[model samples]
Target chain A: MNTDTSRREEHWQRTRKLMFITLTIWFIFSFVVHWFAAPLNAMAPDFFGWPFGFYMAAQGSEIIFVVTLFWFVRAQHAIDKDCGFTEED
Target chain B: MAIIKGDFIDNLPKVYLMYTGGFLGFVLLMAIFEQMGMGSDTIGILFVAFTIAIYAGIGWLSRTMAVDAYYVAGRQVPAVFNGMATAADWMSGASFVAMAGGIYFGGHGYLAFVVGWTGGYILVASLMAPYLRKFGCYTVPDFIGTRYGGNLPRFLGVVILAVASFTYVTAQINATGTIASRALQIPFEVGVWFGLSGILLCSMLGGMRAVTWTQVAQYIVLIIAYLVPVIWMSNKQGFGMIPQLVYGDAVQRITELELLHGMGTLDPVAGAKAGLKALSVPFAAAGDSWQFVTLVFCMMTGTASLPHILMRYFTTPSVKAARQSVAWSLLFIFFLYFTAPALATFTKLQILDPNLATGIIGKSIADVQALDWIQKWSNVGFLQIIDANADGILQLNEFFMRGDIVVLATPEIAGLPYVISGLVAAGGMAAAMSTADGLLLAIANALSHDLYYKIIDPKADTKHRLLVARGLLLVIGAGAAIVASMKLTSILGAVAWAFDFAASGLFVPIVLGIWWKRANRQGAIAAMIGGFGVGTWYLYMIKWGGMDIWFGINDLRFAIIGMPVSLFLMVVVSLMTEEPDAETQAMVDEIRIPTGETVLKAAH
Candidate 1:
């Protein structure tokens, strides 16, 4: 019983940690980039003809979001397997 | 016969692959017919009829009387297919038809919708989808009711789901009406009936099973319809096949064109009409960054809380699949979101650049009005030219077009073949009808499963329950159609309000029900009523009663206020009241792991 409780705690901690990291990245790309869009547009060079902030808003953030989701899935899958918590499908 | 008997259900990938091939072949045949001098209107009608027929056929194939299949598609959908279906379910007429138009008009401020919506899938994957699946509820209300262990929370869940989803479904049906009116040359009022029947034909038969399979097919058609014209336009403009990357140049070109057209300059005659902003400019139409940020936040939370979207996860095969399915959903949705800005840039370029063959802004009014595409769209009241200055040529200010026509009219605007126009209209119908199907199902299922079966009569048999669900689906779908014909609001506005309502009311309770072990029934009920009531009240006050804008949050983002209120009340109430029982806490812990059988299913 003790081991089971510890395992659940460890699994949850790892999962929560991963979720935090993923969400932090999500927030940065989703909000932080857009919030600083004006300065980014002025400071950074054109990216394949797009201003930097516009690229992030229109294309770059979406790409990063997709990558972050896939990364979370793989990482969470590993955590589940390591914790012996994967579903028996 | 053998394939229909069982093999078809087993080989989803194979069947869908062949279906895609068959659909493309049909489109090719239509193209040949156009080449052979088929009438454009006939071709348009055929395209709409054919796609709806295919959806109906799929509905027939997947039709089921079984409780599980009707409610959750027997919980056997693979992650990838569920992702496709969810993509179709998520991308309504707003995303498919009006999104590019929004980007074109609102500039960078509107990318909030794209970013917030896709970013929402991240929330779903991490916080909601897997746990909800593990809880194993047929509807969002099912989860709320079971977790809180009462009928009041369940009833509140049903009410919120109905209101939000009904508002959303009406928008989708309105979108379908717009497409149908254009395609069939029918009145918008009559066209909504066409849209409603197509929606009901699929969902009223097989329920979620029908909706899931038909949505997958619709996703394919909509993505193809969206991509074909944009790619063709890009290649025509010497951008090659990779328009998503190359279209940045078109945005730059449009910015130059805006300057050339005297974007910020004042001319007394055109000053009233100069609402066009530079394409790449940030916070131009939004007035400030705060409004943009608040709008993004509202849409993100709203995306997470939408009942029809969350219900898609319940159809996946397992909890693991649910998590992966969200990722897949985002990926499928990404195809359209990433392309929308490019589509907006290119379509605007087509209109504004006087050097292009498709350019209309500087063209003679008679010539522009004589164009077949212009005449057709104008006849439907979607496009107009006033020549406000009595100038012979059409100025930028003289042109008036509805955003809803942007995607549907893209092929015509780009001077692509009429066949492509037919294809785009069909795709628009698919987008609208698929979403309408899902929303109607979500509303009806909550009524039948949560309100009727769980609350009114727990002893009701499965057959009777499904009968009630199907019957209610018919009634509710028709009600929505009637409301849609009334045109209560613009498609995007109603959709935004729907999201705000869902986020304000449902987000707190659902998230807390998962993560917070001590969330009592009192907290849950308080959160739902308090949040929803606050959102509705704020919306009414701001939109009609002339209240001042709080924190620069507009009527579209009333959730910005309601969500915080709900969160505060929920935490305080949960802590003040008795904690949930051990069984409920254990169920929460079990859902978190995703390894055990579904708790609610086992209990029932």
Candidate 2:
């Protein structure tokens, strides 16, 4: 029981660390990029015809969000397996 | 007993795949009927009726008396299908109907809604979904009641759920009414009843079992409807097949056109009539970056906290599935979110560019009014063209179109066949009805399960409990429809308020309940009451009571004030109060790990 509890604590710590990292990336993409969107758009001529700020706000952020979610799932699953915390199927 | 047999559950993928193919084929048949000279009205009615009939059929087939099936669909939903259902549920009338219009008018600022909403699932997947699933409660309130060990917190949970979901559902019903009225040429007031009846037919019988399957079907229809016109418009405009990737040029062109038409300078007549301004300019419609950031924050937090959305994860088969399901939900939703900007840009191009076949700018008023699509939409009061200048030529300032009609009118605007219009109408109805079904179920289930069964009468058997739930579903749904008919608020405005209320009241309590073991019942109660109360007070004051807007937080983003209060009170109060007993702490630890069976399974 003690080992089990310690294992659960370790698993949660790892999971929480991963979650914070993912959310940091999420925040940067969602808010930080959009906050600087105007400057990004001004630099559009250098980076293809697409307005980088507008594209990120409109399309690019959504794609990253999707990828981030899937990646989080895979990473969390791996943590669960490593900690012997995978649920019985 | 539920009708969902083991074999049937195993074949969900195959079954839904075939259903999608069959639905597309049906749309094709409608297109062929259009070629055969069928009236557009008849085609529209056929599309609406056929899709509703399928939902009603699924509701009938999946009708269940078992408590587990009724509340959580036997907890057997696969991750992918649940994700699709959630996407359908999340994409309400505000999303399918008004979002593109918002993007068109508000420009880059409104993408806040899109970003915040999708980003919310990240919070759900990491902080909430799997933990709640492992806790194994049927309703969100069940988690609150169990975790907090009291009825007050549970009662407050139900109240918050009802307030938020009821407000949200009315907006959806309003959207359904708007779509149905246009499609069937009925009055908006009467169309609401039609929409409500269809919503009832799907959720009243089988509960979650019915709603889950029907929502999956709705997702397929809505995505197809949403994608077809954008793709068609893209190809027609020589932008190639992939509109999502190719629309940057169109956005740039739209920016140029806005300047050329003096839209950047905002005509008083255009501003007063339709609120039209620069379409592609960043931060033009949202007033400034502060409002944009706050709006995104409110929407994202709201997305994580909404009871109906959180309930979707409870239907998944296991904790693992719940975590994965949030990703699927975001992915399916991403399909439409990524396309909305493209649709907005392409439609604006069609209106502004005189070279395009659908462009009406600088055209003779008589000629533009004679256009079939304009005539139809104007007849419904969604579109209006007047020779205000009396020059006989329709200037851009003389044209007025409601943002609500943008998506529905896109097919017609791009000069697509009438069949596509009908399909889009069906899609809009699917989006509205699916969301309404979920909200109605969420409200009804909270009332019956959390309030009545758990608090009012614990002795009530499963049959009695479910009956009360179904009865509440009928009552609450009709009540929402009545409120919707009054048109008290714009669909998007009401949705924004719903999110604010949910975010302020529920987000802190629920998140802390899982993560913070010291979070006692006092803290939970304080957070719920303090957050919700302050938010409501702020909204009432700013919106009606003539209160000053504090720190630039508008009525719509009142949660900005409430959420911080809730968090502050929760942490402070939790520290001031005694920590929860060891058993509850153990329960939290157990929920943190995904290896065990659901803790509350036997209790239910």
Candidate 3:
């Protein structure tokens, strides 16, 4: 019984690690991308005719958000399987 | 259970075909009306009637007497459809009509609204949805009641939920009035009643069951309504059909115009209230960057904590389905959001281009009044062509357009015919009504399920509970309608305040409740009171008391202060007191695992 409890605790720790990494990426895409947009725009006024920072803020960050979420979902599922927390069919 | 669940999925194609056929037939009929030269007012009325009829028909078909069906659609909804409905429910009038308009007026700073709102779903899918599903509750307050092992926490949850949800619902009702008046060519006061009846008809029919199916249909209407004008405008402007990829040229041109005019700089004679005439600011500028980050924090956290949105997850079939549903919702929502900036860019091009504006740069307002679209919209007070300098010709600074007008006026701005304008108005109505129905149900459920059934009549049967839920829905719906009809000018500002309140008051407690075993009833109550109190007080002081900033944070973004304070109180209070008992700890363990089934834990 004690071993079972310890195993569960270990599984939760792995899950938390995944959460930490994903949240860091989420923060960077949401805040840092927008924060540096001006410098990028000034560096290149037109990236394929889009003001560089305007393109990143308006469209680029949103595209990255969709990708980030899907990656998190896939990674979390793998962790769940390894931890033996996958639901039985 | 498996067979029953499969039945809805099996019939989905048939349902899709029937709805599509009916909608196409209505469009054909409208096209014929256009050939007959029907007046714009008549055409607008016909558009409203046709769309409302389809929603009303769906409401009647899905009506149910069972409590399970009324509250959570019997927990049988397939994920993809629920995702579509959630998208429609989540994208309110602000997203549909005002976001592009806000971006149009506020420039890059406004993109924070879009990024903040969509990014919040990351938190939702990761932390809240699956566990809430595993808890297998009917409403958020229901979870609070059982998790805390008492009435006080549950009652307090209801109070906070009602305050947040009611503020949101009133704003949605105001949006409904604006769309109805624009579509039917009536006064906004009369339009409020027309909009209220449509909302009540669908929601009162079958509670969540009616609302869920109706929202699916509303989603189709709104997305089509949103895309058509943008596609047309893109092709007309030579961006081709893929406006999302090629709108950069338009932004470049708009930038050139802004630099030439120095428009965003305030006009001293008109005072600072005249507002931005150009977009010259850089990113990472200290004041604006902090404002942007705080607003995003508030919006994202607020999105995860909103009771109306979270309730949609409870209707899905399993914990995996709940997780899948959030991803699908983002996909559906991105279709509109990605296109919004494009819409703003193209519309700005039309406003700036000499050929589209027609009259010479120095021509009189009278000369520009000859332009049909300008003449029509100005009559409705949506677009104002002010010649502030009393010059006969129109200057870039002379035109002042509101944010709400940007989406609704896009078709007209692009020189589309009357029928397309009517369709855009219908889409706006769909966005507003779908959100209003979800909010009304969230409030009604808090009162009926949490307050009445749990506290007032614990032994009440399922049938009795359903009756009380429907009754409360009508009462709350009427009250929101009355507030909306007052034609308050600050409706949008009020909606922003509600988001700050929800983020501050609900986000910390709800997240810690699920993740931390040490989170006790006293901690949650203290966090709710402390967080909500600080948030509301800050809002009142700055908005009414006339302060510019509080402790260096703007009043509009007070959640930055309120949230951390609440988190501190929750952690400190929980450590000072006893942890949850053994059974409660067991309940949290049960929620943490992703079991295939969503069986309810027995009550405390």
Best by DockQ: 1
Best by lDDT: 2
Give me candidate 3's TM-score against the actual structure: 0.94
Native contacts conserved, per model: 0.67, 0.61, 0.38
Candidate 3 residue spans exceeding 4 A from truth: A1-7, B1-6, B262-287, B357-363, B596-604
lDDT of 2 by residue, B66-124 (tens): 99999999888999999999999999998899999888767888888888988888889
Clashing residue pairs for model 3 = B263-B277, B263-B278, B264-B277, B264-B278, B362-B393, B363-B393, B364-B392
Worst 10 residues of 3 chain B by lDDT: B276-285
Estimate the lDDT of model 2: 0.88
In model 1, what are the clashing residue pairs, if there are any? none
The segments of candidate 1 whose C-alpha lies over 4 angstroms from its true place after superposition are B1-5, B266-287
DockQ of predicted candidate 1? 0.67
lDDT of 3 by residue, B1-604 (tens): 2312347656875786688677767766786888899887787888877899878877887778878888888777788889899999998888898888878777778888888888888888888988898898888888887887799888888988899899888889999998898787788888888898899889886889889988999998899888888998989888899899998888887776665555547342232132223223321122266667778788888888899999999898777778788888878888889988898888877776665543223356787777787777767665666667776777666665567788888877777777888888888899999999999999998899899998999899877888899899999988998998886644456577677888888888788888899999889888888998888888777878886675557655778878888899899998999999999998887787675445463221
CAPRI quality level assigned to candidate 3 from its DockQ score:
acceptable
lDDT of 1 by residue, B473-560 (tens): 9999999998999988988999999999999999999998998898889999999999999999999999899999888788889999
Ranking by DockQ: 1, 2, 3
